[model samples]
Target: MLNGLKTLFNKKSVDSKFGIALRSQAGSYALDKGEDTDIQAGEYFTETSESAGDWLDDLLSSHNFQGSGHLVLSASHYYNVQINKPDLPDNEIPSAIKWLVKDIVPIDPDEMIADYYDSPVIVSGTQKINVVCSHLTSLKKYTDSFKRYQVDLEGIITDEFAFANLLSHRKHSTLIICQQPFEEVFLIIVKEGQIYFSRRLRGFSDVGGYSTEQLSKGICDSLSLEVQKSMDYFERILKQTPVSEIKVLLPVKHENFIIENLDKNTNAQVSKLDLPSPFEQMRNCAASVGGLIEFERKGAEND
Candidate 1:
């Protein structure tokens, strides 16, 4: 009976004006509505529910959601890894990835759901493939939650890929460091729309409270070391040219601190991420905003 609900709720239809970007922070959920690239509304929920039907009822009644659209998920729920491209047929890639990642993934292979993104570039006859894995139980839980509300989940994407989609227009190699509220930070390197490297670092708040100056200094030192390592690997291992600039996505309150500190320490030109007009006041929700941008781009290509 529940399986029927799950299957029924998983339908994804591309023709729509609205999209939803859903992400979990701490114990709550953040949902945003996007009409094309413009954000129309956003709401946060704190209540936790074990019953999907009850949860959906509450969400629908409270938000007054009117139409079905794409649902973009958060990266925290899945494991994203990069592995050497395997020599195999396209149809057999999924099985091969399962076997390769069995020991490394935290969950059992039998209970895992896997997906992959192929790299746009082939270097030295080798390619990099991004693999995303999630536990079947968690997948079912979230799917069932939305299924009860009859929300069509267009696709599941990581925050990294969403950010990559957000910056697809750039022509040169660049590094992106995104720091969200709470204690989450991601470092990503991209060139020509392909991700070469990515890492999530421990934030200053994760360790303990600190003065503004101390926190700024800590982030600067940590970013400098990681940025240097990524640059070295890009040149030495990937044999690619160095990145021309580093773009940091941070809260407006700490933007100056990161920019000033990173500028003094790194050779690359450091700057803040440019947000679209709709997102000018809500820099903190970049992941969700990026997901909306990505969905619109993909939907247009298909049209």
Candidate 2:
């Protein structure tokens, strides 16, 4: 009953001619006007919980985001410590991280520079929070790294925001699977283009390092868990409307089989997400390329 209404509303929204919302990720960029694109860029420098800043700086200096458009550096490994059932007042929310860092995270919170924002909590009436933490030197290193590549860095945005931006057209509940070559799988739930939830699952890989048989089984099993979690989240917490569709975007090679297997695992229609064009289609430039499109779009709107 409610699902029908939501579908009708989504259809109406599409029919109303609202502009397409655009989005970019670590490896892909997509919009409503046309096809989506993938980018092929060289390795992105990454560091674990306690790495030195030089490694990250070296990574940033190798690429370019200037003139490409609006680009966001969505560093995924940040310590996103969050508490749901907060007993504090609304304004006091800022201190939540300070308290968390002191007791929760492994590294010294003071040694890391952190920024936080409040998100509208769709489920519980509790306040929702997002925190981004990185070493202060690491921030400078990232900036210096871009300078090394001679790519003009426009601005930085968190990955979650970028993920939400791409799915803006979804009025009915939707599930998005974001796969990077060696990183964990990211699952995002979109309702009417609003992000209801996001989570990252570790130990997932798509690189050719694994044996063919292992890779096949791994892809299917990982996707299976992703589908299950998406369903569980929709039913147990969201309870707004069931996910009407699931879109899988795998940037690695031989992902077709994985995508095909995903369709068989879930009732929600599954399909590979397409790229917009040369920007996305360019060789080995997925993440950087998508970042460029988004950067350009935001610049145009502001102008």
Candidate 3:
């Protein structure tokens, strides 16, 4: 059956060298703990009759990215759960979003496939948790897209972690607004070297989707709105402190809006993350190169 072919093809494949290049733009940096590098990468999912290893090998060959020891963290998801008394399994801990915004919004717990990882918090007594989940079918489709791109996926990583890695080097509270295809917008808030929160906005691009110019406009507007919203939420609800500075990283081209808007709004420092260092200019695929570099750093530390 076609379903079996698909299941058979979804087996995990490990590469020791590159660790799996994430879906990233050329020259996009992915910081693992702290080192930076250029990367050429893509993301895809498995399909009927397509073995993950075969698809990955073909992708590497076509793209010409080295793949000797790359490893993809496939089928990975992130979610947050508080460290409550251990009566039930940790899985019993409800979604972090549910805990934070339960009164504000009702979420169908079963609808999402959630996972969690513990992280250190700024306060010594408390712990920060990252919760990641997505519609199961949707997650699979995301993976499949990488397979479709014919790029060998060394591993799978959540977009949140990717964003986290991108912002790891930054200090002070920071906000990241990214405009994806179809006018989808993602707003991330980070502080003390970790993700504090995030929000997504849809249909903010073109009415139907995106055109080159329309996407540019959407990026500008979305960044402005998300920054305002993040500032307000941090002050009013979280009641801690608002981000002192905001940094915007774009794939290029539309970077002007990020600069212009920041200049117009409250005094927050806004700039591009993609070009943190001038060396980033030399690489064509920054994210992929960043991925490889991050992997290399981790590998080196382990040894």
- Cα RMSD for predicted model 1: 4.5
- Give the number of the best model, judged by lDDT: 1
Candidate 3 — number of clashing residue pairs? 52
What clash count goes with each model? 0, 22, 52
Look at candidate 1 and tell me the lDDT of residue 224.
82
lDDT of 2 by residue, 15-123 (tens): 0001111112223322222223323334333344344344544434333222222334444535565655356675664545555655665557666655565543546
lDDT of 1 by residue, 209-250 (tens): 344577565656886887788788877877778888988887
CA error at residue 176 for candidate 2, angstroms: 1.6
* Count of clashes in candidate 1: 0
lDDT of each: 0.64, 0.51, 0.47
TM-score of candidate 1 to 2 decimals? 0.82
Candidate 3 structure lDDT: 0.47
- lDDT of model 2 at position 24: 21
Better of 1 and 2 by TM-score: 1
